[model samples]
Target: MKDSFVAEDLMDLALANLAWFDGEDAGDDSGLGCNRDYRDLRGKTWADVRRVLECERRLVADFRAGEWVPDEPGDGPEVEDLELGVASVVTALSALGCIPFTSCNGRAFGGEHDADALIVGFYARPKHWRKLVDLGRGSRTELQVWDGALWLQARTTEDMLRWAERAVERAGPSASHPSLM
Candidate 1:
C-alpha cells in the first residue's frame, strides 16, 4: 500500500514535517523559524535518505535472489511493520509534504496472518467524514477530525486516497501546509 511521489520533493516535505513539529513547541506562528532547522539539516537528511534507499534496494535484491534467510529473528510482520511497509508509507507521505503525526498498519505479532488495521494521524477539514462516506470510501476508511487533526484507519491504500483527495482539497493548496502534523 504505497502512494506515488517524487523523491526529489522529499526534502521540502521533510521541512514541512519539521515546521509542523515547530508549531507544536512554540505557540508562536509556524512561519517564524520553521525553515531554519531544515536548512541546516538538508544535506544530512539527503544523505540519510540515500543510504536508506540503497539498503532497501539491497534487501529487496537479496530477497528476490532467494537468499532471504528465514532463520532471521524478526523476519515477520512485526519487523515488516518497522522495516518496510510503514517506512515506505512514511517516506511516500513525506514526499507529498504531508507528515503523519504517528501511524501503524497493524501487524500480527509473529506473522500469524492476522494483521487487521491501519492507523494514520492526518489533518483534514470539517465534515470530511461525511464526504468520505458519500464517496463510498468510508466503509473501509474510518475518519475522525473533531479537534483539528484527522485520524484515520483505512483498510486499503485505495480507500485512504479516495478520502484523502477530498480532505487535502478542502485544506487548500500548498502541499507543505497539507498536514497538522
Candidate 2:
C-alpha cells in the first residue's frame, strides 16, 4: 500500500473497531465513550488486543512491501484477503513514529474547560504530562481527557490527523512514540 494513508484513516479504523466491540453501529454511535473504562481503558480482552496487534504487524509488512490495499469491497481489495490489514495500519503508524498512549499508562491527563490542558506523559522516573493546549487552538471543540484517557470529538479524517499530529508531538522522544519497524 502507498504510504499515503493519513492519520485520520487510522483513527477512524481504531474507532470503528472500538465501536464494533461495544455492539454499536459505526454510523450511529460515535466513539466518544469508547474510553469510559479508564482504569483498564486499554484493558481489552487479550484476544481482541492481540487481533489489533496482529493487524498492525501485517499492515507494517504490507506497507514496507508497498502492497497494502484498503479493504473497500467493490472499490478495492477486501481486508479479509489482505491478512491483518487493520493491525497492519496501526503498526505502520507506530513504525512511522506516531506515539501510542493509553489510559493504562500515564500518557493522558484529565481536566475541565478550554483552559484545561491535554497533557501527555513522558518516560522518566516520574513521568510527566506535557500540556497540549495549543492542539485545540482556534477550535471550539473540546478535546476530552477523562481519567488519563484522551480522545477528540472528531468525525472526519482531517480532524483525527490534527489530533494525532498533536499527540505525536506531545509524546516526544519517549519509547511510547511509534517506531518504524
Pairs that clash in candidate 1: none
Q: Listing every candidate in turn, what is its Cα RMSD in Å to the true structure after a full C-alpha superposition?
A: 12.1, 15.1
For model 1, the superposed segments whose C-alpha errors exceed 4 Å read 1-83, 108-116, 123-143, 156-181
Q: Give one digit per residue, the lDDT tens place, for model 1 in 45-71.
A: 222333344454455456557677445
**Full-model lDDT, candidate 1:** 0.38
Off by over 4 Å in 2: 1-134, 138-141, 144-151, 174-181
TM-score of 2: 0.26
Over 55-174, each residue of candidate 2 has an lDDT whose tens digit, in order, gives 444544564575954454223322323222222222223333322232111111121222122222111110111233344443222344333333434332233334444434443545
Q: What alpha-carbon RMSD in Å does predicted model 1 have with respect to the real structure?
A: 12.1
